[model samples]
Target: MSLELRSVNYPRRISLMRNNKSRLSGFTLWEVLVVLFLMGVLLTSFTPYYGSASKHVRLQMNRANIQRIEGAAQLYKIDVGTYPHSVTDLVYSQKGMSDWQGPYLNEIPSNPFNSEQSYQLDSSGRVNNSSAN
Candidate 1:
């Protein structure tokens, strides 16, 4: 009886291994390449939308910076009794006026649209996002 059991188990194990080998394996190389190509096509289709969103975010950031600079210039005018001649006065300590209590801004920011352009102040101390002219 023991010899018969061993003979049966050996044949069963060989048949199981043959069954596993015959079963369908995972994706083929061609299938993997097709999936990668599809992903690339999907990404390219969304490229224009991503570009527009990025531009919108940049424009909003530029607008916010301009507003902050304007507010700082206004605060400087209120404390010192006159509009500053340039935006630099808001970030730099002016000589001789004890009321000029600022360093209102830690640093001046450059224009986002064109870095070569910088924020400027109009005669009324309003911030302008353009080259000084």
Candidate 2:
């Protein structure tokens, strides 16, 4: 039978070609390397002075705070006739408040450098002369 037989396979190839899809997402190696280099440059610019300036600021601030505490204590002594035995005595009346002019300074001074220890006080409630170092 020499009847017309148009190729059936030809139509299936066209359908398969229509179904294919290609899409791309995510950073290439070059893009990731560029981002890392930019971060490194920024970090290097600020790193040199970052540490010293922070320390200087802390030390100066602590010195000023200690000075303020010293002044408050002087005022307390003038009114009470003697410094309290320790810093705690200022907060709670240990000896007597007959002449106590405080609650001097709301509470007590705190260490600016390490909050683990408060600004040191001597046996008496005065600032410890050696605490800063």
Candidate 3:
């Protein structure tokens, strides 16, 4: 009885291995190629939407930068009884507002389009406008 059981188990194990091997033979070359091609097409189709989203995010950042600068300069203006002598004054001036609380922004805002076009103070020797060209 024991010998018979061993023989049966041995064949059963071999049959299971053969079944696994056959299943692993799996997809045909054409099927694999079709799946890869479909994925490539999907990636290509999604690229433009990703690019647009990225562009929108950057533009939104630029707008936020403008607002931050405007707020800081306005605060400085209120404190000193006038706007800073220059944008650099925002950075260097210790004699700002009495209620003046801040390093206002971390770094000066730069125009996302033209790095050369950072936020500027309209130094007409009067009130500063952060949006001046």
Candidate 4:
């Protein structure tokens, strides 16, 4: 009976192990690109709704500010016997207005729609947004 021992091919075994390790290691380029594409699509799809939601919030804040100004004006009228001539009058004393009891508001709130402009006091003693027209 004869016993035979064969030499192992070490380089070939190493090469095969490396190949298998690479295949199982990480995501392929195509998979990463697909995930990025899907994320971009989701962001684009939600962008318009996000913008409208923020605008809706601004509109609601505008309405609330107008209501606050209206309430202050009513208080001013009760004290001074007339509506304020301007929004500034609510936060400062006016000349020749002896009945003035204000500083009704801490400060005049800027118009939400247009930050550069202040809220308008209409001829009817109502508060409005000039930029809205």
Stretches of candidate 4 exceeding 4 Å from the true structure: 1-19, 95-98, 129-133
Candidate 1: give its CA RMSD in angstroms.
Answer: 3.7
lDDT tens digits by residue: candidate 1, 17-80: 9888776667878999999999999999999999999988878878887788889988998999
What C-alpha lDDT, on a 0 to 100 scale, does residue 49 get in candidate 2?
91
Candidate 2, residue 10: CA error in Å?
A: 23
lDDT of 3 by residue, 19-115 (tens): 9999888798989999999999999999999999988877888777766766778877766666655556666646634655556566676676567
Query: lDDT per model, in order?
Result: 0.84, 0.71, 0.70, 0.83
Candidate 2's displacement at residue 107, Å, is 2.2
Off by over 4 Å in 1: 1-25, 129-133
Q: Model 4: which residue pairs collide?
A: none
In model 2, how large is the Cα lDDT of residue 39?
97
C-alpha RMSD between model 3 and the true structure: 5.5
Clashes of each: 0, 0, 1, 0
Candidate 2, poorest ten consecutive residues by summed lDDT: 1-10
Compared with the true structure, model 4 gives a TM-score of: 0.76
**What are the models' TM-scores?**
0.76, 0.64, 0.63, 0.76
Residue-level lDDT tens digits of model 2 in 36-121: 99999999998879988998889898888788777776777888887655565556665646888677777776777777776666
